[model samples]
Every structure is written in C-alpha cells, then in structure tokens.
Target: MTSTNKESNGSPSPSDSSKGLWRNLQFARMFIAYALATFGDWFDALAIQVMVAYRWGADPLIIALIPVCMAVPGILLGSVAGTLADRFHKVRIMLLCDVITVVLTIAILFAPNAIWLLPLLTLRAMMGVFHIPAQQALTRQVVSEEHLFQASSLNGFVAQCSKVAGPLLGAVILAVFSPQFCIVINACTRLISGLVLWPLRKLVQPKQWEGKGLTGQTRTETESVLTQWVRGWSFIRSRRIILTTMLFGCFGLLAILMIDYQFTTLFRAIKPGNESLLGWLASSVGAGAVVVILLLNRLPQIGYGWGLGGGFSFIGIGIAALGWVTPLTPEIWVIVWGLCIGIGNGLSMVTMNYLLQKETPPAFVGRVFGIQNSLSSIVLVVAPLVGGILIRSAGPSPAFQYIGMATFMIGIVGIVLQRVLWAEKKSPVAALQE
Candidate 1:
C-alpha cells in the first residue's frame, strides 16, 4: 500500500494549509452544500416538533417518540450505511441520499397526521444515516492531513451557525406561514444541496483502493456488505486509540444527553413565567460553539487529549452551575453557563473528527463513523429515559448536579488515560496497512 502526502515537504505549515484548504474547490463546494443541508435539517426538525405537539396535539409519550423514530434507523442501518459508503463511490452515495431526502421532505408536507408523519420522518432520518458517513469519508479524501483540523473546525462552525439560524428562521416562517411551508423550504434546500454536489461527480476523484480489505484479502474483489458491517465494529475494537476515544466520548454523551432535554423543566422551575428565555438559552449554547470553532481554527495545533478532556470538563462545570439556578439567580448567568457547554461541545466534536481522520485508514473511515453513530443512538435512547426518571423523582437540580459531575469526571479520566494509553505515538493507519 502507498500513502502519498498530499502536501509538499511531508506537512505544510498551518497557515499555508488553511489557505490551500479554502482554495480546494471540492472542499469549498462541499462546505456550501453541507451548510445548506444542515440548516434545512434543523428547520424541518423544529417544524416537525411543532406539527406533532401543537398541530396534532400529541401527548407527552407520543412527542417523546419523535426522537425514537429518528434514532431507530441509525441503530439498525448505520453500520450498513457505512459499509455502503466504503464499498461504493462516496460522492454518489451522498448525492443519492440528498435526492432521496428532497423527495421525502416534500412527502412530509402531505402527512395529515402524526401517524403518517412518523414513517416519513424515519425514512428521512435513514437517509441522513447514509449521508453522514459518506460525507465524512469524502472529507478524508479531499482534505489533506495538514488541513484536517481546520476543515473539521469549519464544519463545526457551519453546524453551530445552522443550529442557531435554522430554528429561528423556522419559527419566523411558522408564525407567518405554516409548518408545511417550512417543510417545503427544507425540501428546496435538499434539492439545492444535490444540485451543488452533482458537479463533484466529475471533479473529485477518490483514491484507488490499494490496500487489502478488512477481511484480509486484496481489494480486487468486493466483500459482502454484511461482512463489512460486522467487521467495522471489530476493527474499532482492534485499534486502542479509536476504541478509547469512542468509549469515553460515549460516556460524555450519556452524561450530556441525560440533562440536555431536561433544560426546559429546569428553566420552568427557575423562571416559570418566562419559558421564552429557553430560546435565548439554547442560542447561547450555539454561540459558544461558534466561538470555540473560531478559536480552534486560529490555533496552530489541537491536542486530542485536551480537546476531549477539556470539552468534558467545560460542559460538566457548566451543567453543574446550571443546576444551581434558582428564582433569584440572574438570567445572564444561565446563558453564560450554556455558552461554556457549547464550547466544550464544539471542541470535542472537532477533535473526534480530526482523530478519526488521522488514525483510521481510508478504507475503513466510513465504517468507523457508522459504528460510532450506532453507539451514540444506543446512548441517545437510554440517556433520556434515565434522565427523565431521575429528574422526575430527584428533581432537575440534583439530577443536573449528579450528571454534570459524572460528565466532568469522564473528562478528567479521559485525560489521565490518554497520558497512559497514548504514551507512545501510535499510527493506526500504518498499523492497519502492515
């Protein structure tokens, strides 16, 4: 197997690399298309919630099922999607998924009731499950190693901006127009993303498959999708750096997910009359993420340990402070805490992407992300239920404190483990190649 350094002199300086990354037409196209698609996703997400809770008058249990519908596809088909991303041309997969999503988003507009909407939502989410891994894999193909962190930071920035902007725009549209209108807007964005990406079919050429397959055979023959799917999990397990980061990352996720949804309840307790502040509070988190993404882009380097550990710690501290909010507590303080968590969120995400690209061989990048998504789905399903029970019985105050501390500890432990486990500079891609 041959690994060509895309940048001259083995590694280009950070400033040069950043400029090159922006100049790369493939990355530029992807960035614009991804931003449009992500904004549309968040817009439709808010639209769906309003449609179910307000329009259809869904009960709490039914409303809770919304996330379950979205998550179930990732749990079931995520790894399979990854295998498909690895087996086929990733650009084609991304383009196909975008087109399918455009169709499904339009179909969502016609659903008269929650029953019909749920299935369409699930199918749309399934397309996302396929789209994400393909996008991540393609990113590895286009961005050189020197510029990966910048690319990751830029992507995170787009996502954070979309999170803030999409819901706000959706709210405005929903007030002036209708949920169906918002759904239509989402469909148009998807269509636009597809059109933007269509030209990449002729432009970005993927590296030829040069290494042995994960099943210990040459890439001359195709492996069954099921075999690749199963091997994806084992492949992660075989690499210590990937496995450790993934496990600890999920731990942090469990801690965050537990308290994330309960913020509304907490806000209600602190300031019962102004549930509207919740929007500001949520936007604050996105603001924090954007700040951190910008900071990361300016930095010459990012340490994986610092990104994961510091991220966990910041979020943990913020969440813990958030638990202490009382009627007497100032609203400004709460927004500050939310901002802290957002910074951590951005840091961890960018680091995770950077690590995956740095460590995983090109052959297995898609499967790695797919397996990660599946694991996250498991945490997503379990965390909310447990958090709800804890909050119901113990109240949000104690629940936040406990969960926040646990999250903080996860970060501290991650740092200590990184020191021990990564004492040697291990090259997972090189090891896999051998």
Candidate 2:
C-alpha cells in the first residue's frame, strides 16, 4: 500500500498509476448502480415535497419538518452507520439498504396523512445514512488510489445530472400522472439498483479484518461500538491533513448552504412573475458542474488543495454577484452566476471525496465518511434557518453580498494554509529516529 503521506500530497498511487478509470469494469458497474440510485432519490425528494405542500395542504412548519425528518437520522445514527460499514461487508449493506428503501418507498404510496408519511420518509433516509458510508467504503475498495479523483468527479457529475434531470422528469410525470406514480418509479429504481449490485456479492470478496486501527492502534473484534467510534474521532484528530480538509470543506459548505435556500427568494425580488426563470437558473448550475467535471476528468492529475481553494473562491464570487441581479439585470447574467456556483460545487466535491479516500485507510474510511455526513447534516439543519433569518433581517441583496465576501475570505485562508496543513508528515519511525 502507498504511504498516507504520499497519497495525501496528491502523488499518484504506485498501484494503478497507468490504469484508466474507464478500463476498470467494477467501477463501471458501480457507477451505473450509483447513477440509478441517485436519480431515483431525487425523484422521491421532489415527489415528497409536492405531496406534502400541495396534495396534503400542509402548513409551513409541517412542510419544514420534511427536510428535518430526512436530515435528523444522519445526525443521530451516522456514527453507528459508519461503524457498520467498517465491520460488515459493504456490498451486502448497500444491497440490504436498497431493498429496505424500495419497500419503504412503495409503502409511502399508502401513507394516508403527513403523520404516516413523515416516519416512512425518515426511515428511508435512515437507510441512506447506512448506504452512503458503505458505498463510499466500497468505492475505496473498487477503485485504485490514483484514479480516486476521476472516480469522485464522475460521481459528482452523476449527482448534478440527477439534480437537474430527476426533478424535471418528476415534474413532467406529475403533470400527466401523480406524485404517487413518481414514488412508485423511485421504488422501481431502487429495486433495479439492488439487482445490479447483487452480482458484486460474488465477484468482489471482502478482506478479513486485521484488527488494527489507524497509527498502529488496536481495534480488536471484542471492542465496544462506542470505543471504535471514539477511535475514529481520535484517528481524525491525529491526522492533521484529514482534519483540516474536513473542517475547511464543512466551513465552505456552511457558507454555501446558508445562501442555497435563499436563491428563490432572491429571484422573487428580482423578477416578480417569472417562475420558469428559476428553473433555468438551476439548470445553468448543473450545466456548469458538468463542464467542470469533464475538464477535471481529462486531466491526468489534480492538486486537491488547488481544487478546494479555487472552488470555494469561485462559489463566493458567484454568490456575491447575485446581489447585482436587480430588476434591470439581464436574466442570462443571473444564470451565469448560477453556473459559476455549479463550477465551484463540482471542484469541491471531487477533491473532497478524493482527499478523504486517499488519507483514510479502508478500515477507518467508513467512520470518517460517517462523521463527515453527520457534520454536514448538522449544517444542513442549521444553515438554511440562518440564511432565512439573514435574508429577513438584512434583506437578500445585502445578506448575499456580506455572506459571499465572508466565504471568499475563507477560500483565501484555505489557500494560504494549504501548504502548512497538507505538508507530508514524518513517519513514526523517522520521527522516533530524529
């Protein structure tokens, strides 16, 4: 195995330096399965919102609870999910989660009221908390180290594509059919994803645990779950690169998420009656992401630090530009701003995944990602409310400008700190000898 120091510094792994990502058949299959599952998830997401807000005529607070239901499970159970990913067979966990999700999604059609729908939605989201860590762990296993960035870029591309296509498809279906029909389609997608992944159970065998944790710490089979979970946090703290990357990434995410939910409100102020322009702006973001992913994939290698810092800076600038979107502003420029934000999203996501996978050992990767997810979920829960408050008190334009500038400064700090934070660390033996 390549040393963590080498990989963390963006050096190509010796294992698969020459192998192209497209040539890896296992990754191709996994990509297809992930695309299907992610696309299906968006369908369910849009359908559920429509069901709650329109079909059920739910109040604003009740509608707000929908996202809360989805996010809270990750906040509560992410560590446990990550631990399971480390201990169990990842393929099996993904398969089981898919099956359970399919059942729950189908059951959603029969939900008589908001009370029943909320719990079912929460359970389905809980399945995702387990599924994500397992899928991420599985990605580390299937892809060689050198191609991790390309693989992560491709995954982000699929997600962005789904974010655009899924809702458009759901909207079209809802126009002709019903949200329940869309839910049924989601169930089918999960079922097919399970079927596609089922073959991997035989082809990709699980490695036996060596009962070793990070940095030569013991992680015996007899250890308690809490102990292992605590160890995961310890491992992160001990690795400065991983800890810094995760913290800075989450900080950028906080800034972005704070403004994410306010875009529509901003649009409303800029143009009162044009609803379709919002959709076009969203599609522009997806288009921007797609462009960046394609560009990154063509590169032989990428510097994780540059990707992270540049991406956040681009995002901050894009958000700040929105402040200029007055009634006199051209709609095309607004879309261009959205595209800029998308570009930043693409850069950050690919590098973030690559950094985490490269720095974390397979044994701890699940826990690492699990904790990352939990932290993100916390931001997801809080950031939107803060964004709302800021918009209401400061107004959208001023709030956007201030928040955007703060975020831009964060990116600058990340760039300045990257050299110190990501410098290759001395090995234990070398340190002891010195």
Candidate 3:
C-alpha cells in the first residue's frame, strides 16, 4: 500500500507534522461527532437567547443567567467529573452524556416558555459537567503524546468553526421556523452524534483505578468522593509549576471574562438595534482564532510563555483601544477589536492548554484540566453581573476602560509572576520545557 493509503487505513503511524490532520478512521469519527455536538450546543445557545429576549422580555442580566446556568455546573462538578473520568470508561461516559444532552435538548423543544428553560438548561449543563472531562481524557487515549498539542489545537479549531456557523444557522432557522424547531434540530444533531460514538466502546480502555488494590479498605478511606475531590487539590499543591500555571489561568480568566462582557455590551452600543452585527462580530473573533490555529500548526516548536504573555497583552491593548474608538465615526473599529480579542483568545487558549497538558503528569491530567475549567466558569459567573452593575453605575465607556485597565494589570502581573517564579527556580527552563 502507498504511505497515504496505509495512514488512511490506520496502519502507518502519523508523524508529528500530520498528527492533527491524519487521525485514524475511528478518531475521525469521534472528531466529527464532537464537531456536530458542539454545533448543536452553539445552536441551542443562539436559539435560547433569542427566545428569552424577544418572547420573554427578559432583562440583559436575566438573559445572562442562561450562560450562568451552563457555567455553574462545570464549576461545581468539575473536580468530581474529572475523578469520574479517570475512574470510568471515558468513551462510555461521553456517550452517556451525549444521550442525556440530546434528551435535554428535546425537552427544551416542549418547554412552555422561558421559565421552563432554566430547568432544561440546568440538565444540559450537568451533562456537560460529565461530557467535557471525559472527552479530554478520551482524546489522550486515542492519540500519541507527541500529537496531543495538535489534537487540542484541532479541537479548538472545530469549536471555533462551530461558533462561527451555528449561530448564523440558528438565526436563519429562527427566521423560517420557531425557536422550538431549532431546539428540535439541535436534539437531532446531538442524537446522531451520540449514536456515532456508541460503537467506539473498544477504543476506551478502563482507567488505572481499576487495577488498584483496596480489597479490605473502607469505602471512605479507599473510594470516597471527598477523597477523590481532595486528591485533585493535593495533586496541584505538590507541583509548583502546575500551581503557578493554574494561578496564571485564574487571573487570566478573570480578565478574559471582564473583556468578554464589556465587548458584548460595547457591540450593542456601537450598532444599536443591529443584532446581526453582533453575530458578525462573533464570527470575526472565530475567524481570528482559525488564523491562530493555522499559524500554530505550522510553527509547532514555539513555547507557551511568549504566546500566553503576548496574547494577553494584545487582548489588553485591544480592549483599552475599544474605549478610545467607541466615540469615533466609522463604527467598524469594533470589528477590529473583536478580531484582536479573537486571535488573542485563540493563541492564549492553545498555548496555555498545551503547556498544561505537557507539564502535567498523565495521571493528574483530568484533575488539572477540570480545575482550569472550574476557574474559568467561576470567573464567568461573577464577571457579567459585576460588569453590568459597573456599567449601570458608571456607564459603558468607563466600565470598559476599567476592564481594560484591569486586564492590562493582570497581564503585567502574570509577566512579573513568571519572572519571579523563574528566578526562584534554579532551572527556569525546566518548568516551561514540559
């Protein structure tokens, strides 16, 4: 067989350059399934937002609650979910989550009104709590370690592509059909994705926990949920680099959340009554992210330190610039800001996550990632409410200015902390080399 044909048939192992693009048929199936599922998620978000705003006449903060519902579960259940991911067959867990999410989506179709959305959204979020870690763990299982960065980048790319497409499709669907109909379509998409994953059972091996001996150990001492949860924290504390990286992530997410909220509000101000413009702004961000992914794919040897710091610096400067440009005439400057944030977000996400994955021990991967997700969710939960209040009290421009300043300060702090940590460690490059 030709080399290409051998690779296609899962016979020839992939080289680093082709790792992300040349997944085996089984991995390709899972990738497509994940892409479709993510599309369904974004579709649901767009449909639900429009339904809540136009039909229910909900206030902006109230509308924000929809995302809050989605994020809260990830924050609360993340560690436990990570533990479970390490303990169970990850693919089976993912399949189960997809099924549950599909059921929840269908339930939303029959939801009487916006009020009914809360409960359904809660269920969907809970499913995500199970889905995300399992999905991450499974990706590690299917790919070689050298390919992990590529796999992660490709995953981010697909997610960004969905963000670009799903809302626009939902908008077209909403114009032609009801939001309930969009929900139905989402349910169908999720159902098909779930079915596609169901047959991949052989790909998911049981975790190392199954091999551990604790025959005479008490449940509390051996397999307690509390112990499992604490184990994640303990793992973090033992690794100085991991702890430092997580701290950076926490501050970075806090700044990112502030920027995200302010940018959405700024978009409204810049193009009053033009919701499609907001969609375009979002698409611009996704487009920027796609560019970052493509660039990183070509330059695999670059370290995370420069990418993380530089990306945050760009985001900070872009956010600050938005405050200055909002008063200008053309109004397209908002799009430029959107593009900057998008590229910055994309680059930062990939590099930071790659660093974490590379540095973290395989046994603790789920827990570390879970903690990162929880930190981001916690920031998401708090930022919007506080941002709204700040805007109400001090107007949009000042709120954005404050956000930019805060983000900049945080970036500076991250840089300083990295320097200090490096200085303290005798071998600075060792921590980052991972």
RMSD of 3: 5.0
Ranking by TM-score: 1, 2, 3
What is the per-residue lDDT of model 1 for residues 277-337, given as tens digits with 9 covering 90 to 100?
A: 8888898899999999999998755888889998999999899998988899888998899
RMSD of each: 3.9, 4.9, 5.0
Write model 3 residue lDDT over 1-434, tens digit each, in one string: 44334223312245533645464555676788898899988886778887889987888867767887888888888888887876666778888898888888888877777678887898898888778777776665555556667767878788888888888888899999988888888899888888888767655352332322112121233566566667768767866767777777677777667657565577667556666666666777888888888777666544555567666766776677777655444657667877887887787788777776665544456666777778778888887677678778887767777777777676666565665542233222233233
Query: In model 1, what lDDT does residue 355 have?
Result: 85
The number of the candidate with the highest TM-score is: 1
Q: How big is the positional error of residue 302 in model 1, measured in Å on the Cα after superposition? A: 1.0
| TM-score between model 2 and native | 0.92
In angstroms, the error of model 3 at 323 is 0.5
User: All candidates' TM-scores?
Assistant: 0.93, 0.92, 0.85
Task: Give the per-residue Cα lDDT of candidate 2 at 413.
Answer: 77
Give the per-residue lDDT digits (tens) of candidate 2, residues 127-150. Answer: 999999998988877677668778
Inter-residue clash pairs, candidate 1: none
**Poorly placed runs, candidate 1 (over 4 Å):** 1-19, 203-209, 213-217, 423-426, 430-434
